[model samples]
Target: MMKIDIPTMRAQMAEGDKKRDTGLTEPTTITAIKELSYGPHGIENTFDIYYPVGTTTCLPTIVSIHGGGFFYGDKELYRFYTMYLASQGFTVVNFNYRLAPVHQYPAPLEDTNALMNWLLIHGKEHYVDTEQLFLVGDSAGGQLAEQYATLTSNPHYAGLMDFAIADVQFKAVGLNCGAYFIGQTGAINQDFPFYFGETLPEQTAQQFPVESFITTDFPPAFITTATHDFLKDVAEPLATILRSKGVEAEFHLYENPDGKELHHVFHLDQRNPIGKQCNEETLDFFRKFL
Candidate 1:
């Protein structure tokens, strides 16, 4: 496969995250099913499902998309955090999607579709109540989650995609430190090929934004960011747009703790008290529609 030529920034970022999660330990209260493949990409397409150890009945499910600026991250990186979510009473699916430069636009989206289908087939056997499904993503994963949710809800946008839409109803979505408005930023003009694998025509570009494709059918959302997150500016605008379209939108901007700015995806760090607080609030938001 001819991969796109990109910088080593992804590697550097991955190292940083590994360091961030180094000392954290997952709680023993949850049960985990690991390394199940949903697509043909071997380990890259594999997933892990987490739920409370003694769960007897199906529970509300949260399918989480991992962050890495579209080029990095995996189920293992989210292992502890997803376990924490499970401990709090939910079945959580965390998985790896094909990354960019190696696998371009729509690959992760398609993988997301495959994962959903996989759940539809295997979910009941594993305590996933697909009927009460929800989506969550951070950073680049946020973009993928938002886009996938839009496709599931909006027929007009779903028609433009290459694959059949995944048949799943999302109760809500959590967009954490994510970019929701694409192409509105000038970077899209040049970064298109790097991520999407082609230069889009002006009209197509205009039609491709996550915001533009969102409809009233879009799932209710919990959008969040910290004072220092680069994507902090995106959450409010996305909530505004969703509200304009009659979708329920709850946006939260976290203030710094002890006057220290919180970086992007700070909620992923289980050690951070503020991150835990944010997760609890996000869970409360998801529970509302349940």
Candidate 2:
């Protein structure tokens, strides 16, 4: 298993963000409203909305959940990429949840539930078509996305979390290099305590298995990963399971025969050519629901 030094990994991510900051550009035209609080969690529960500039037309909305091994990442780190999606003519809600090892499992998931409720109530003020909502997540956020998607449609799953799913219905779900499994203990994600809290890994897995929730009524999904991603192996099984359950699912593995390896959640960087293509393809998949 590959052990991660959280401190060093976080510093490296922040440094990368600094470098990417200077090269960031809007796709064509986009505007952002920053730091709007959605719930009572102070700044951690805030969200940013990005949409086309000077347009009041209701657009398909993409609610983005970011990835950082479940303990790191916020809307600020994801602004540029979300803005690019907005420029593509979708209203994007990029949000932050309280991090783990401090906030723990269901807290973040609860925050996700609350945010969706908030959007459903307040979305029209921003010209968001709540009926055409799509959920997008990367890496750890993918796990959150899958959970949220399932919770919204599965009463049993929603009962496990003790929160009713929001009234807003999802048009589709888009997962990028998602970490979808929590069953294995030796999967290089040793910080399960941050997510599982006092619960055992096996119990946590039983409670939140993405595969178990994949029924015919489940929404369509677009799942993407790269050959070099550490989480690559988990992607195919998820797509296969979704299909087996009679749900529409598409899985893409980005491979570069030229040997340029793309790591996990590469799409979040946006500078990677393959990542850019993957982002465009994911957005295209969302369009099918429209």
Candidate 3:
């Protein structure tokens, strides 16, 4: 197991994020419904949905998996970014999942599954076009999004997880600065224990590269990373791997026109022009399927 001060790290991350999101309000163009429960874990299992204001037609839905190292993050923190997605004429769902130290591997995954199911059951209430679903995740959330999308198409993996798959197909997924080969990727390697709770056998471990579980059935992907993203290396390789498996994958590396640096998950910043471009381009990718 990786050595980590779980409580302290959580506290520190929460503080840092609070400052990062200071004064940000939900977008005026989007209407948001907050904290609707979808699972047994109460708050941790709750989700929020965003919709373009006053739209009567069923819209393409985007389920957003937030990132904070898989241990910290909630729908509230991602509200602005997701609302932007809703503003683009998609219904967006962002949820809180049970975090590590208290919950393990399948917990967060299970919560995601539950949220997807809830959406299907409540489609009319949320103005979601269940058949036109898409997913987007960044950082650790990217890992969950990938894994969950895998579970949907890979029955064997879903069985191993002992969780039922979400009963919907994703038209495509946006993986933004995601960490894929979990156990082998540096800092992400250390968080493996935080994710799975215990070690597994060699064969099972081998499948965790996230590549082994992926098949041609996986959804097409739009993978992106900033010029200076810590996980920039993960993007292209994943795209190549997906294309090799006969899945459509698009890769983009956003370079700053200025000499300034663009760090991890920079696309989440609604105010960044480049970030807006990144978001719109991803939406464009999803539009191709629709």
Give lDDT: candidate 1, residue 37: 87
RMSD from true fold, candidate 1? 2.7
lDDT of 3 by residue, 113-166 (tens): 888888889877879888999999999899889988898888887777556787
Off-target runs (Cα >4 Å) in candidate 1 are 1-7, 185-189, 201-207
Write model 1 residue lDDT over 1-290, tens digit each, in one string: 22433467767777887888998777778888888889899999999989998999999999999988777778898888788888889999999989876887778999999999999998998899999999999999898889999999988888887789889989999999997677775545354465665565554454467778888999999999999999888889999999999999998998765888888999988888889999999899999988
33 in model 3: Cα distance from truth in Å? 1.2
Per-residue accuracy of model 2 over 226-249 as CA lDDT, tens digit each: 989999998998899889988899
Per TM-score, the best of the predicted structures is 1
Clashing residue pairs, backbone N/CA/C < 3 A, model 3: none
Score candidate 3 by lDDT: 0.85
lDDT score, residue 279, model 1?
A: 91
Best by lDDT: 1
Model 3 is weakest, by summed lDDT over 10 consecutive residues, at: 183-192
Better of 2 and 3 by lDDT: 3
Cα distance off (Å), candidate 3, residue 251: 0.7
Screening candidate 1 with a backbone cut-off below 3 angstroms (N, C-alpha, C), the clashing residue pairs are none
Which of candidates 2 and 3 is the stronger one according to TM-score? 3
Candidate 1: worst 10 consecutive residues by lDDT? 1-10
Runs in model 2 lying further than 4 Å from the true structure? 1-5, 26-28, 184-191, 198-206
